[model samples]
Target: MSSIDPMWRLTCVYGELRTENRQRMWNTIVDLKNRSNLPWLVVGHFNEVLWQHEHMSETKRPEPQIRVFRDTLESCGLVDLGFTGVPFTFNNNQSGRKNVRVRLDKAVAIDSWRDLFAETEIKHLTTPCSDHSPIGLTLIKETSQPTVRKVRHYEIVWEKAPELEEIIANTWASLEHNGDLASKFYQQKLEDMSRDYFKDLFAADPNITPDEIVDLFETKVTNMMNEQLCAEFSDNEIADTLF
Candidate 1:
């Protein structure tokens, strides 16, 4: 995560030489674009250039392949930010006419980024021993606190019967925390027992909704509570187990 635009994501890709692999790379970018409308930046060694002029002293660049790359960016609503340091980001490092260079490395972003982060800048950096140039992205925006989400947990079905509460507690306390006969193993045993107890609920209806199952569990718990009350159990004892 960055200090600026914490909600946005920056994705980098190392593209392949083969045509099909390169097409897959652009398709991946479009997939990422569909995931969010937030400020996003996709940049890296794309290996394909949009224009013939991007290739220097090489054979005429393939048009159909470049068209796919352009179409992918258009569909994803991404625009090239254009570089600063050099014309060509990659070099074969070969000498004379054999030398091949193309502006394949790039930085692109969604249009909404201009509205949110108005002072963002892209800079190309020199690479010492690599074919591709490194890039620096500066997104200047006001920082806000990150949002936190709360997660909830449910306990085992203790609410079914008042007598079952003390029975389960004593049985659980007697088990070891680790080893073959551990609490975890016994907990799984209890879960299987509960499922077996509720097996008729599933068998009764071929298309029972999750809500219906929960409702059935609640009804069963309530009935158990009433049974405990009739057996002259204390109010506290009747409220023992919860599902």
Candidate 2:
């Protein structure tokens, strides 16, 4: 009944708890598969496992039930995108042998979808509030553009210092301008200049004491509160703020 440009489809499912009732969900997916040949992704809690290893608990899952789910995926041409991080997504939160965990949540994509998103990665992220872990999907598209190299430059207070020009002249004059050695010498001079500048800039002020700095901060805070925070509000202002 609807169409998306570039012909891609996504279906999100929250399956029935009852195995018998889940047949309707599978039937609906199969019906949708017949309608389009677009890149398709089906994701969510299916309430079913495709393999015995997908379920871990005291009681084993019935093979027939898992087989039905596997058969459904095969019929739809949907393959599990696999995942990173914890193997299981659902936890029963019970202690010891009473505990149960299963990979109930997942993302499955058709071959067409795989071709478009060849660099897809699915991550299983756990949350404290929910028993079920959320999954993160990343799709990276291939690009023809070349990666640009990044160059890092340090911002220094050299312009503020009057002796900067003399330092630059002496450093530049001392460098060996033969080839690569000249480049290395220049870099060393730049590092030395930045280090000396920072040392001078952050050197403690002998004129001011720590007590003076603390008093200044306290005075500023008190003045700010008196000018702004301590100001009385009008009845309309209070009403507006409360509202």
Candidate 3:
């Protein structure tokens, strides 16, 4: 048993062990405790199950190997972190032919060591080539919050009953002025107005088009001019207005 850090220490034992070898395994655990300091984790395949129920398949005769494993665990003052999902660690893939499964792999830690591994997880993965499904262990680490960037907002406005020639004329007139302030002010105001109008129109009918709005504005102006011309007294003017 060696201390990896001030808080963490690990000891492992591997390989197959029969009933006769149980005493040697227990002796190893006892020696490690007498040799190592506090706050340690003991993990690996212990080839022995504490209970007959730990095996997925039914065993008609209870094995003395299980009793020895349980007693050794109690003697070492270790706590068993239960299997995450399926209890069996090895499978033969033969359902009824030669199905022999067992829980051999395990992780055991002291009481103080539990707090260091607060978010530990164990998962089993399917393996086509091997007899045992791969077991994966995960340790979650705390992370700081991510920084985010701010986004700028923009508004777009459309000109009402604006002829192409008039737009060009106004743009040139603004350019001819001493500063570009007038052009910028007009452009910004138009964009804001267009955005407001489009927002209202979109609320009413989201599919409204720019061309349709322009046509509507032109039609309204033409109708107003026609009405004013009609109100004039000259008969020739009324005729011209009607035409």
TM-score of every candidate? 0.53, 0.56, 0.52
What 10-residue stretch in candidate 2 is worst by lDDT? 212-221
- Candidates' C-alpha lDDT: 0.73, 0.83, 0.67
lDDT of 2 by residue, 11-93 (tens): 99988899889889889889999998889999998999989998998689999988888999999999999999899999999
Candidate numbers sorted by TM-score from highest down: 2, 1, 3
TM-score, cand. 3 vs. native: 0.52
Residue 59 lDDT (model 1): 77
Top TM-score model: 2
Q: List candidate 1 segments past 4 Å from native.
A: 1-6, 141-243
Between prediction 1 and prediction 3, which has the larger TM-score?
1
The CA-based lDDT of model 1 is what? 0.73
What tens digits encode model 1's per-residue C-alpha lDDT throughout 1-243?
A: 567734777788788888877877877788888888788778788888877888885577888988888899889888888767678887888865578888888888887765666677778776556887777777764477657764323333435535556656666677734456665556665666566657764465656456633543434457778877678656776578441
Alpha-carbon deviation at 205 in model 1, angstroms: 92
Q: After superposition on all CA atoms, how large is the RMSD of candidate 2?
A: 21.9
